[model samples]
Target chain A: MKLSHKELEIQSGQFGEVRKLALEHQMQVGKFFDAQSFVEISQVHIMADTEALGLAGIEYLENLAQYPDPQKQVWVPTITDPRGSDFKSFKKIKQNKRFVDLEKRAIDAFKQLNVMMTDTCINYQVFMPPVKGEHLAFGDTGSSIYANSVLGARTNFEGGPSALAASLTGRTPMYGLHIEQNRIPNKFFNFNVRPTNFSDWGALGGIIGKQMNSYWDIPIIYGIDYKPTSDELKHFGAAMASFGSTPMFHIAGVTPEDHLAQNKNPKMNNISLSDLNNFYKSYLPKDDNLDVVVFAAPQLSLNEMRILSELLDGKKIHPKVSLLVCTPSAVKVLCDKNGISKKIENSGGIILEGVCFYNMHAREIGEANGWKRLMSNSAKIINILGGYGYETILNSMEKCVISACQGKIVK
Target chain B: MKENVYFGHIGIGEPVKGEALVADDNFSARYDLDRINGNFSRKSHKLFNQSYVNKILVLNVAKGGVATAWMFRSMKISKICPKALLLNFANPIIAQGAAHANLPLIDRFESDITKIIKSGDIIKLFPKEGKVEILNEKSTN
Candidate 1:
């Protein structure tokens, strides 16, 4: 990957080993195609959720910190899931001054990058509002799917810290779905019928993602049987992204992919009815009897917290139910600043970090504790961690919270 | 180019004739496929799919190396345990470390202890190709 002359000149200005790596990475990325053909990013946000490699992550952050453009907005989720965070790694480290200096360095980077640094993924709606067709580099799995599929924001499924790198560089390879030609699904889902409810819609997404996970292909939903609710879309996106790598999707007339409506002989698998049953059976496990419920592994958004707060306020979790709430690094601060964290704490819940139930192996805790039924509002969590003896329920954050209080699936 | 064995293409080894529980990543293994019915009920999914318990489990990257070790420690390894192997594609030096860290339980399957091999090396061993960079373990931030 040869760096163009202009790119080489820009790479010269970067400081520190981390920033230098960021430059090298971008330059190597630059060689991928026309150097000038960069993704147009007006504002940038970095969703650096917790991963196991601390030193490597710090380096990744260092690269993310050195944003070439000062105007780019940035955000980083702080330590929300202590359980999932490499605690063993934390204990083993000889605690260098560099370790203590990590948070401050992260703060400094955020300040320099003008980052909004919120740990909450659900709150993207409040902290930032990306219009349809905006290209921004963000890494929160839920936010990534939400931004691209729901909000119509465009970005690839960036991981391995590249989202942070893109935020620092303010450009991603204008390839894949970032390119318009790719947005038109190689496959089309002809749905002359729309579902009447939310779960059905999400179930539909699960079906698609499962069938296509291996293909790395996107499908345009031609006729949705019904308009899915917020909860429905959330799970649908999570399940689809989980089984398959579907970063973005189109509902025919709803999204940009509608243009392919008339393309005869569109590539598709036409999901058989049995496959739909498998999709439901795949994520929505049948055992609903449970011992506990969990929310906030990657940290809950204000909306999620709001629902939990509203549901659990006057209510008490079943005596046998042990509910745990996790918030992101940013939300922990916001929760502190606003008092939402206190509310959950007062309700006899623990506010831990691990982004989602998938974080820190909390689902393992449910299994170990003999939780027979597990419930959550996150599609990603369900899609990723749906396999325990526990019955997994896919519902809105609101319904999930209510169910937690009542000790039953609150329809 | 023909020498590399990409994923999705079936490998040439004598098939293990067992219930294969395949997941794209650790979380999916832990969450999506453990239940016999349709609900969430468990303290943890360290071991999912009772049917595959002593069968064969092919895991992808598990939270770097530490989680891989911890995951194995939690799940009991019996005589029927599936062989574990860390997937080390030939690329940057950083990823080799990841693959080594990803499957700490690889050596437990004494009969089949094949953990770290370059992507190109897989062709000599398995002879199928489709680009098996499943979890993108290398691109960790």
Candidate 2:
């Protein structure tokens, strides 16, 4: 890859050993992708929860953190994704102290490196929304897809190590979605039906994702009668990225880059209502007894929190069932200030801040609490928990709320 | 004893030899694995419940979340990782993860790797050379 003078300096350790190591890692990835050069990135989001980091990863960070040189700090604004455990409510979910201790160590290491602990996969929604055509290195697949498709910002799915590397160097390999020609749609989909709720939108994304199950295949969707809200697209993109490693998508009239698909004739597929139903049918409840009803994965937006809060009002949760709601710390602050958190808590639900469920040592916690059957309105979460030894049920938020109250799957 | 060789794009980590565990399915460290038990745990996956430890995993492509980028290193630290990854195609997450973990990974083969390679085939991978060689042919049973 062609390196600028500053990049060459960083590579030569003129900055610091930490920055030089970061550049070397980026160069290795860039060479694998055959990236021609480095693109300066405006911001970066790192997704290194303690569960994923393990002891070695934390040690790696601590070694980098020990470098006290100002040049070792991140060159661009850097933030974080959801942590492994929510300190205040981890015990409520049966996550033990060891996990929290690891989390604290990871946080301390990040702080020493001058990284911000935004702890959100929904950073595009809650924190800073990237402008159109901006270059960024975003860690979470959901956030990367949303920024690329909905916001028209350019990014590939920057993982934890790569994102941290980019944070230190303030640039990433100029490959994948960073280039304009690659952004054009290669596959087309026509929607026969519009999504009614967030879950339906997620199902739509799943159908399309399963069809175009590749990082290289970009799908251009058509026939949406109305503009979908940001929260709706959040579930849609999150599920798509989960089911398929889809980096970016285009909605013919809805998304900003739909015009890029105008002159190309890509293979077309139609997504029908039956397709959505079949996607949901694959996750049908086995016996209806539910242990947990979670509303997370991409974490909740303020609007989703308000809707969930109202859903729980005047209702009591079943003593056997646990309803866990996860949101970013920023959104949780707003929820607390606006009584959304209190309303949900009063109805026997637990609100976890700065933590998403799947990454929070999910398998261990499930075993601890004997949580066998899990239900969630978020299609992304349901898709993920299967490997963690839970029989996941997918449904709408209202139905999920009803199931939580009754401690069973609602028909 | 005839050996068949195939070439791919030069990849990450050191060259190594291991028994191949081939599948036409895609992979994700977070979505398709029980990392604690070192097996393919997702029931829908073709290699469901199969142990992947110390084997060369030959798959179609990489899929799902960015957690794989970190999970690979974590799995390596715990001594519960595949010997190497041989995919027909790799997403950035897999490539980045293999780099982070210093695990051998080679992808973008001239042919479908999963079809050409079978489970239990003794294979040698030369990542820097972008080459994979099978030492034994399938026996007629």
A-chain TM-score of every model:
0.70, 0.98
DockQ, all models: 0.11, 0.81
Residue-level lDDT tens digits of model 2 in A263-315: 56666788888888988899996578899999999899999999999999989
Positional deviation of A314 in candidate 2, in angstroms? 0.8
Instruction: Report the TM-score for the A-chain of model 1.
Output: 0.70
Candidate 1 chain B least-lDDT 10 residues: B88-97
- Every candidate's CA RMSD: 10.4, 1.3
Instruction: Give the alpha carbon lDDT tens digit for every residue of A5-106 in model 1.
Output: 534544675333443454555443333222445554655444433323233444544655554553233323221112233222322212223433554454
Clashing residue pairs for model 2: none
Candidate 2 ranges beyond 4 A from true positions = A262-265, B1-3, B138-140
For residue A357, give model 1's deviation from the true position in Å. Answer: 3.4
The best candidate in terms of TM-score:
2
Q: Say which candidate scores most in DockQ.
A: 2
